[model samples]
Target: MFLKPLLHDFRLALIQLHVSAVKSENLQRACGLVREASAKGAEVVALPECFNSPYGTQYFKEYAEKIPGESTQKLSEVAKECGIYLVGGSIPEEDGGKLYNTCAVFGPDGAMLAKHRKVHLFDINVPGKIQFRESETLSPGNSFSMFDTPYCKVGLGICYDIRFAEMAQVYGQKGCQLLIYPGAFNLTTGPAHWELLQRGRAVDNQVYIAAVSPARDEKASYVAWGHSTVVNP
Candidate 1:
């Protein structure tokens, strides 16, 4: 449904980034896209999951970095430059010898507002289809992430976290008006529940939902189902 924009509305832009193996190139491309989106009047911009690296369990450690490392530093610079609330999509984060899928948020002043690790790891096996195990290389986060903007209160999550309705409910109960999830659903589950899950969460919470995803790359090791979407209440 087309929810009409309010007089004091904010424009949210989702970048369906095409991830590559080259970490530097991916970061550069993502910053450029954020700039372009901001120039076009996006006050809040979000990137796709693992925009700085290809999606897969094997590649997590290779591309993982500290929070204040290279990737988030760029995100901070760009957010300040554009004067926008920037959601630096999910990345492979290395902390305490454990790797976690984490999403970082930055304010217009370049201050990081929140760091949400993927609370639920995506581990599923479907016979004759897709079998993936994130828990093999990644650890789960124990908290929910939320922040505030001039326009509304925002809740944050990574890909797999959207599947759990209870978490979204908690965010809703905590007075979040919008929920953002940077996801990279695979070919097997993307078509099946990607949009469905987002809609379900939005309806259940009575809020808006933005589920951003990486653009599909045919040559990537693990293909991502790229249908970045937003659902209104």
Candidate 2:
């Protein structure tokens, strides 16, 4: 009798999410996608930043949920049902009444694996285009977070945090084989900076980098530049 080979491999799914003001609708869409990815044999699925809410400082307070709040609960249930690892993406989390842009990860068993609040806020001014002041509504995260999975050691980073090479280096130093960034890069920077930044991070760290961005929203207060991508080491 021939024995089947034991495989210790992993596959990733990047969700180029399209967010909206309706949190319930977005959650339903994300859950559906996650299920589809799992059915397609993805062991891990990642969603874009602010998947549970709208991006922009103005909507932070209104959309903010607690860490283990509704958004996380929904993601946890999905992760458990699909038997896959899930990066729940960044959501506006209300911590002690202050808002923080946060990302949560769940294991195959739906256990909370790790959480990372966006350390670098998107605060920039581009002439004749968009202006973002994340600090005005959201507080910056002070601690760095990483976790282990069945596939490999993984690093976590939210949208603007990807722009910092130092952070990526830190993850590389921590023995991370793959880094996940959930973000919403805008039209102003998305076209010029998004892919370049992902490639740069992968080249610099010599590791796989996956970035998930919310699909473009032209009618919303802030338009998202969406081109969800994955790059290998």
Estimated TM-score for each candidate: 0.96, 0.95
Instruction: Using TM-score, give the best candidate's number.
Output: 1
- The 0-to-1 C-alpha lDDT of every candidate, in the order given, reads 0.93, 0.89
The best candidate in terms of lDDT: 1
- How does model 2 score by TM-score? 0.95
Would you list the clashing residue pairs of candidate 2? none
lDDT of candidate 2?
Answer: 0.89
Residue 24, model 1: lDDT of: 96
Q: How far is candidate 1 from the true structure (C-alpha RMSD, Å)?
A: 2.3
